[model samples]
Target: MATWPRREYFYYFTKMMPTGFTLTVDLDVTATKEWLAARDLKFNAAYLYLVSKVIAQTPEFRVYRDNTGQLQRFDVIHPAYSVMHADDHSISSLWTAYDPDFTQFYQNYLADLAEYGDQRTPMPKAPQSENTYMIGSIPWTHFTSYTPLPFTPLNTFFPVIQAGKFEQEAKRWQMPLSLTIHHAVADGYHVSQFFEQLQLAFDHPEAWLAS
Candidate 1:
């Protein structure tokens, strides 16, 4: 684990805040959708893998406070998300280890779904790991803005991301993505970096799809 310098006032101030801030933006996902469709890949799995890949490259996204109250950075971050079952219309929490390899990650994700997708009760909360982020998808609606309710105010270091429905505009497809992160761990610049990286990935899906 790595720690940020005490002299970073922004980190100190934002970490002490009662709540985190959210930013929402529309992302062009035309290339991504096309790549996935060509390979018969699951959209959610591919998108989630892209998100994890970007987060792994951004150190700020991995910064979080440990149980001992020490700020630390994780070398790897996992994803925890919700999956809906088609059988009973139930939702369940699913946690999957992050893998840079899209194929491996997608396989593991499918395995988790097959094992617990039909379960009505929420899966036991995974042990709190500062290296994990919460993710959700709302494929039913295309939204311009979103605000996520905090599960806990004390530990808002890890980010919460929600991907809304995709819309077709002429020759392009766009997705609404909302990200909530603790201001202490990152600033607007860091958020912009994430979005920029994500957009690049979407624009060139072949770069990731072949990995």
Candidate 2:
């Protein structure tokens, strides 16, 4: 623990009353959406792909302690997101294993969506992957602020991501994205770094979205 960069912050925050905070920002996704539209790709899958790619590259988001009480960083973190069922207006949790290769990951996402997207059960994939984090969308509303609280707060440290409806202005599309993070694992600076990279990814779809 001596050389761990977040040692002090982790201890201080987790020992306090509240240990996490959520920040929402509007990200311009004009180029990304255009690219997806041209390719006839699902925006939700692409969003999860881009977001998880950035999360894997950011070390702070990958930090967690193991069952043995040893601090460890996951080599990659997968996305466990919500899939809405059109039939009965229900939502089920689905997860796709993270693959750094965008093509492979997108294919995996499509396969999962095809199989379990319409399932009647709440959690089709029960006992989700240990190295997965939450990512979902609220397509019905464009929320300016959102907070997602875990039932067992201190027991989790992974980041929770939520996206709101995207609306286009004169020349650009803006999507409200909220990121909830444990203060022990990250601060505003770290969160800003992640958002900055994410915005860049959204702005330049050709960089990583090309098939």
For model 1, residues 83-153, the per-residue Cα lDDT tens digits are: 88787777888788888888899998898787767777787444544467888899999999889876544
For model 1, give the 10-residue run with minimal summed lDDT: 1-10
By TM-score, the best candidate is 2
Tens digit per residue, CA lDDT, model 2, 26-52? 999999999999989889888999999
* lDDT of every model, 2 decimals: 0.82, 0.88
The candidate maximizing lDDT is 2
* Model 1 accuracy (lDDT, Cα): 0.82
- Candidate 2 deviant stretches above 4 angstroms: none
